[model samples]
Target: MDFETEQATRYQRIIDLLSPPDGTPTSTAKLEGELEGESDDIHEAITDLIAFGELELVNSSQHGRVRLHQPTPSTKAQATLTDPTEYVWHAYITERDGLGRTRARRLFKDREVAEEHLKQIVNVETLTPVPGIKKVWCASLGSKGYTPEYAVLRREPVFQQADDPYPESR
Candidate 1:
């Protein structure tokens, strides 16, 4: 996970620990030991949570006693703390030469995004500057354990100079 996600998830954990009747005011030293982080980082997280209105310091002079101020965090805050979903869907846009050999391929996480990219390539909506783009297509891929299977979702002819260009050349 990236730093932001990691930090937010940690913040969520803190909220869960200190929110409600189950939780009581805890010292900063005890929280740092529980979290297993540098004193500075723990202090920073505590300060941030306090500013976010999820936590409050019970003793300003002690600067170590803290408790949850809000039982529930906002939806936006929860969203930042949510774990990223695994991507099972894979889409691709491929470029082929006259010899029916793949010249290039690009992967996308979404099918529609891949199809839109393929459309741009086929229509010359974007300048590729490729000399001979005989065919282009969008393909969906699936994986089962170690094996991968591909199925073409969309195909379009591009600069087709010949119906069969050097058919036996390969």
Candidate 2:
């Protein structure tokens, strides 16, 4: 089937799984197990449903239940758009010692600033720029000891003064 059809089918499957005609509450774990290997699709469907106000989470001590959420026309319209606003590009620097142990790490909003700072702090010939995305939830909740993954955006040359290009000459 087509992409939209497939997505709609997945959404319907999730809805049917959660809100069966019997009205029995399905636990999150059970729903996950039923969905099996299609975790990503299931996650996206649930997120979309929640965003559209078609689903709500009922949290319990053991497991959560998915309940139907009655939505207004506006919310349904907003949910139809698939673009997510919870993620943004971020720049990060990881400094390692001679033994390759992590020495320091810094995060920056601007990519150029991060590259410049990396060039100054460490005496490497080039700066290895790492690109990543910061999530709104993690930033707002303040994770402890959690390091984000990054991709290499670009390499920057180490700065050198005009007269003192060779430090040994000075």
- The TM-scores, one per candidate, come to 0.36, 0.34
Kindly report which residue pairs in candidate 2 clash with one another: none
The pairs that clash in candidate 1 are: none
Candidate 1 accuracy as TM-score: 0.36
Tens-digit lDDT track of model 1 for 71-118: 322333333323423222222322211111122244565656755655
Q: List model 2 lDDT by residue over 1-170, tens digit each.
A: 01355556676777767543233445667776888776556655554444333456555457556665422112323343234222222223321111111222445545566555544554223432111211211111113565421222222122122222222223
- Model 2 CA deviation exceeding 4 Å by range: 1-3, 21-24, 60-63, 70-170
Off by over 4 Å in 1: 1-3, 37-40, 71-170
- lDDT of each prediction vs. the true structure? 0.42, 0.40
Candidate maximizing lDDT: 1
lDDT of 1: 0.42
